[model samples]
Structure formats: structure tokens, C-alpha cells
Target: MASFDVESLFTNVPLHETTELIVNNLNISHLDKFGLDKVHFRKLLGITAHHSVFCFDDCLYTQTDGVAMGPPLGPSYANAFLCHHEQDWLEQCPLEFKPLHYRRYIDDTFLLFKHPSHVNLFLDYLNSKHPSIKFSCEMQKDNQLPFLDTMVTNNNGIFHTTKERLAWEPRLTIGSMREPTPFHEARLVSGANSFGRHCQWVTGLQVLRSQSLRCSHLDFVRNTGKRTIIERHRATRC
Candidate 1:
């Protein structure tokens, strides 16, 4: 039995591919002198060097005859140095508020504050505590600063988003919610139905053409008795 009902009519014809025309070419040129790749540049930019405070003589004295002893206190020494610096910074904080959260990994540090005043306090603390380390707040806007992959703001706010490619732009939303509509569902169903109808129409046309050609060839062979004519001529000559 045939699957399609030829009596049914399809209203809309679906387009398989769409073409777009652009008026201008919008390619930008590189402006940096170093010509280093993005990964290398990021590594160079993010680097922070922390020198070990332990002297060579002290390290040597801590080591034993066969094996180095004294509980492998490298991390302890670094932590102690950082703590001393942090304490000094806290003493001079102007806002009369300290960070609610503090995280540090090697030379990288993160400080979280509750308000704009706290951010100012933290900045002053940082300047006084670690004078050798430089601070750049050029990217900050409206009391918002970027720390690692998050945007930290003055109102005790933190915003996080997925990491994207270099050429991508972020789309931000504050507080918005949307409900699904019947129109969207109908549009999807209509698209699928149109696509299926066009596919079936094309397939039917191809099969019909092929069958017509095959029938025409069979009729031509029946009408022309070339093989029989040749056989009769040979028999007559014999």
C-alpha cells in the first residue's frame, strides 16, 4: 500500500537554504608590537613573582646529614610572610571594615568587601602592606572590579558567567524571566510539517519520472523487432 494520500494538499512550500548579502567587510588589524599569541600574553600579564624570604644559610642549616629535615616548611614560611603583610595592611584600613572573605594562592590574592567604602579601605590597606606590588584599577567602573573570572562590585555583589572566546561579547541580564508561548510551539510544528511535505513531494516526483522512463523503454523494445528480424534473416539464408 502507498503511504502518502495524494488527495491531501500542502499550502506552504519550504525553502531548504537561505542566502544573505553583506555590504561591507569588517575585519580589524592587529595593533600590538610583540605579536605574541593570546595565551602567551595572558600568561605574561597574569604572572606575579613572590621571592622566598628564607636565606640560603638558614635552609642549609635546616637540612640533615642524609635527608633534609624540619618538616618541609616552605609553605609555612610563605604563609607567615603573607600573614605579616596582611596584618600590617589591616591596621591602616580607612573604612573601619575588613574583608569578609580572603583567598590567596601563591602571589594571587582575592579580597571581598561589603560596600564601596570597604573597597577603598582594602585598596589603601593593599598599598600600605605591599608597597612593592603595583595595583591597577583602570578597568573598574561604578565601584565594580574584575577579580579572576568574576565581577566584584561595591554593593557586596558578585557576578559570574561562562568563559567565552576572545571575539565574543557578553549579554547580561539583571532580573528577568520569560514564559513559553503557544506561538513558539506552533511555529516549530509548522516548520517540521512543511519540511516533511517537501521531502515527500520531491521523492514522489523522482520515483514517478524513473517509472515513466522504464515503461517507455519497455514499449520501445516491444515495438522494434530487431532481434527477431536478424534471426529470421539468418534462417532464410541457411
Candidate 2:
């Protein structure tokens, strides 16, 4: 059996003093300029926050836009603005927006690339551009990637899962300020279940598998909003 060293996986690599110095000298200034607090920002931007509630004019929306009409407006607008405000952000973002090649539902982001280098480059770029956004990546060889309950394999021979890529929970301790959670995860999972039930309700089991299969063909899908058991399973599978 393949062994997983959970402790090793979770080992805390101490930040070098020099690295801290650089961050203090260079990155800290930028972070401060943006009015960002690292600890708070990380909590707010963690995987769980991806599905936090976002109230916009009383119209509910999931970060993934699974139930959205046309394109989900909030994240789309936010990302576009970020891209424009920070040109470097776009250069580093793993998702391709040219033809709208990527999809995001809160913390979960799905992207397609022709080469592994593209993925690495994009990840590196993201790290350089937005040092605030914590990311972890895994590669699947000769298999479909998971996305929510669906699995997506692109025409370019790349695959992605429609599921949350990371597991996160908020740690609220005394003396630590709380961070705002993104509602994408909770919303997407709920929306997917609702949509799935709606499909099953109206279409019945005869067409359920086909509908699910078709949905899985999407290039990107997000499942963070609802935080359901099935969504967790999908993420684990991915």
C-alpha cells in the first residue's frame, strides 16, 4: 500500500530569518499598502471561506456560478478588476480568461493547460503576484481530475475535478482577530445538490446518469459552496 506520512505532509517548515527579512523589507510594504493582514487574510481566504455567504443586493450567488444566470457576476467582476488593477496578477493566474477557459466556485479553481510546465509557471506566477493566496496543487497522470461530483477531461488531454482541492477549517483562538470567510464552498455544494435533485426530480433516474455525465464534461466546476458529504468525497477522489 502507498503510505502517506500525514505528519510529514503537515510539517511546519520554519520561515528563514532572511526570508522574513525580505518579506519585511519588500513584501510587507506591498501587503500593508493593500491594507492586508496576513493572518486575517489567510483565514478569510482559506478553503472554507471560499463558500462563505456573500450578500449583494439581496440576490444570492455562489462563487462557482453553477446556478447563476449567464456568468456569476461577483467573482467575475472581482477577478477582472484584480486582473486590471494588478497586471502581474493575470500573468500569474493559472486560469486562462482569454476564451474564458477556467472556472472558479469560491476556493476551488479549475484550469486546463497543454503542458505541466504551464501549470507550474502559472502557480509560480500566482505565488509571485499574490503572495497572500495560499495554494496547493497535485497532478494526475492518465486519469480524469475531480470537480465536485463531476470529472472533467479537456480536449487538450488535461483533466480536472469539480471538487475542492484543499481541506480547511477555521481556527479561532483568543487574541486572534477573525477573518471573513468566502461563501463559495457552501453555496456551490448547496446549489449542486439542489440542481441535482431538481434534475432527478424532473428527469428521474433514467436520465440522471446522462445529465451527470454531461455536467462532468465541463472544463471547470466548483463545489465549495455547499460543503456537502458528496462534495467532500469528490474532493478526496480528486
Candidate 3:
């Protein structure tokens, strides 16, 4: 398995060109779901897309090319554009090197190749598809790599999930129980679900050749228990 990240996805994708491609290729009959006609839909897409904007470091300047980051719409639009572009590569890929499992989250992608011998050639072909969108891949280390919030591992031929060591830890609760927000409740439930999923994954899987657990597993259990039990006590008091 090989994984890659699209470098500066939002800032590099050509917004106008992507929008035009989307508008031109969109199915006209499906426009009613958005309560819009072809012309209106095109206008809305174009209007909402980012254009030139002033940025000042020491002095003022205008940024051209890709959409500016920060706005919620920027990632959604960029992901759509990139996804469309990537489909072309997939369609044209040779059968011997086709990915067995392809998963993507926005700009990050994980690809599993049936024949490991062809991985390098396949990775090069993927990068060659588009000049602007370049992918940097993580070569498999001990048949394992991080993908999203999980560490995906291949033991012999089977796949297993391990926890990802992120820069910041995940929260068990968003706020105090006295805050009277639904987020606290939602977070508690989410935390429990995450714990259950973790336990399920590691039941029969070994982390390393000599060990069954890692620092992440210990941290996950400790932090999750501490937060949830404390949050539960607070909820009972309220």
C-alpha cells in the first residue's frame, strides 16, 4: 500500500478552469435537485468561486490561480475538482497495476496495489497525470502507514487498524457538563464509539513482532477513560 498527499490542494487548483469544467460536464436534468437551471447554476458556481484577493505581508499583493483557503466552500470545491481530475487517471490506468483498494479523504489518498513490484511505476504514473496537482507518497514501512486517524497495517496479507499518533490528542468532551450544550453529550457518545471501534480492531492483531500494544493504544485507553469517567461524574452532579 502507498499513500500520498496533494500539496497545497486549495491554493494550487485553477478555480475558474475547474468551475468551467464542472459546469460544462454537469447533467442538466439533475439541476432541479438544487432548484436551478443550467444558466443559474453556472452563474451561482462562478459567483461563489474565489477570484483575485489582496494579501499583505510587508506590502499588498493579489493571489492568482487556486481558491483562497479559510472559507468552508474552498475545500468542498477543490475536492470536487481534484476528484474529477483523478478519475481520468484511474480510468486510463493499466489493468496489471490497478489499485485493489483506493481510499481518499479530501487531498490525502491511500492506494493498495495487488502486485507490490509495480507500485513505483504506478506511483510515477499517478504523479504524471496532472502537472499542477502533484502527489507525494509515503513508501510502505514494515507494511504499515498512517491514513486519516488510523494506522493501516498489512500483516502478511491481512489488514489491521492501529491508532494514529497525531500532533494533538482527541477530546472526550468539548465542554463542561454545566455548559448546557448538546456538544458535550455528542462528544461523550462519540468517545465511547471510538473506544469500542479501537478495541474491536486490536482484539486479535499484534502491533509489532514482539508486542501487542503501542504507546498510542495505552494513551487512547488512559485518556478516553479519564475524560469519559470525569465527564460522567460531572453529568451526574448536574
Candidate 4:
């Protein structure tokens, strides 16, 4: 398995690609949903992307490329832009470079492959996809790698997600219980010291709330000496 992190995601997002992705996803029939014409929205986004300016070294400079990192639409636009390239790469890249398993949390991505050598090939493909959007990779050592909120382990061909050695807070609470959220809650708490103070109020998949069990109920019991319980509403792990 390998983990990939996009280097300088927002600042290097490529404004042209960002505008295209947004226009493509912003459907015309959903005019009521978006409350604007597609062409008009495109124009607005173009201005927003192109008109971004910043002061550095006591000089004002116009940003010629990439969406600025400060706008409310920055995350959504950049996400759409990156996801488009990833989707295209899935179809165009070599089959050997394809990942056996893939999961992305905003800018950080985790991929599992059948052969270790395929990782280098895949990273090459990813970096070549866009000059501005490059990827850095990490291969698992000793069969485990930290990803998002859990430690993913590859046992034979079966992949398992667990939080056995993940870091957590001592004073987090959920209802009547006191527990902590681990790593990225879809990047909501990616670099946060405190979940609430460092980031905005947001929620994610049940995994964000409780990463308390493994893929196997039997394993949960064998390790923790406790009966397995449901998370949110699902009996299955997310």
C-alpha cells in the first residue's frame, strides 16, 4: 500500500482546470439548485480565479494561475478539479499502475497495489498528469501505514482498517461517553490541535465519529475483550 500527498494543492490548482471542472459539475437543469445560469457562474468563477492578488515583500502581485487558498469556494473548486484528473487517470493510465484499493481524503490519498513496483509507476503517472499538481508517495513499511484516522494493514490479500496505534485526545466526548476523534475527519481536523477551535463545524462518514472496531467483529472481541457494537446506525464498518 502507498500513501500520496498532493504538494501545494490549492495554490497550484491551475485556474483553467478549476473553472472547467466547476462548470462541468454545475449542471444547467439544476438552475433552481444553484440559482444561476451556467455561463454566468463560469464568468463569475473566472473573475474570482484570475483577479486574486496578494502582497509579498511589500509588493502587490496578481496571481496568474491556480485558485487562491482563502475563498470559501477554494476547497470545493480544488476538490472538483483534482477529482476530475483522478477519474481521467483511472481510465487512461496503464492497468499495472492501477491501485487495488484507493481512498482519498481531500489532498491525502492512500492506494493499495498488487506489486510494490507499480507504486513508482503510478506516482510517475500522477505527477505527469499536471505540472502544477504533483504527488509525493510513501510505501508501507513492515506491512502497515497510517492513513486518515486509522492504521491500514495488509494481511495476505485481505485489507484491514484499525486504530490500534492511532493518536487521540484525552478529553473528547460523544453523547454520554467520552472519546476522541483520531486523524483526518475528511481533513476537517487534518492539522488541528482541537477539533472545534482549529477548524469549522463539520461532519463526515461514521468513521469520523467512531473508528472503534475493525472489519471483523470477531477480531474486535479477541483484541479488546468486549462485545462489538454498532457505530452510528450501521453494523458494518465504514
Candidate 1 segments whose C-alpha is farther than 4 A from its true place: 1-80, 91-95, 130-134, 137-145, 149-161, 164-238
Could you give candidate 4's per-residue lDDT for residues 71-138 as a string of tens digits? Answer: 66577556767666777777787886688777675677878788999999999988888778889998
Query: What is the alpha-carbon lDDT for the whole of candidate 1?
Result: 0.33
Off by over 4 Å in 3: 29-35, 58-60, 167-238
Per-candidate TM-scores read 0.28, 0.29, 0.63, 0.63
Worst lDDT 10-window in candidate 3 = 174-183
Q: What lDDT does model 2 reach? A: 0.35
Q: Name the regions of candidate 4 deviating beyond 4 angstroms.
A: 162-238
Candidate 4, pairs of clashing residues: none
- In the range 167-213, model 1's lDDT, one tens digit per residue, is 55534322221221111222212222233344443343233235364
Residue-level lDDT tens digits of model 3 in 1-238: 8877888888888877776766666665555544556576555544445433332432323356687776444755676677677777777989888887776766777788887776777777888887778778886888888766778789998988877677987542212111111112222122222333434333312231124334534554575653442233223422
Worst 10 residues of 4 by lDDT: 172-181
The sequence of per-residue lDDT tens digits that candidate 2 reaches over residues 1-238 is 0000111111121113212222233333344544554453333222222332332543322343121222233332233223232344444444542212344433344555555556656555554543334445555444555543344555454433353334653332212311222222233222222333344322322232243633542312343333343334344432
User: Candidate 1, residue 159: CA error in Å?
Assistant: 4.7
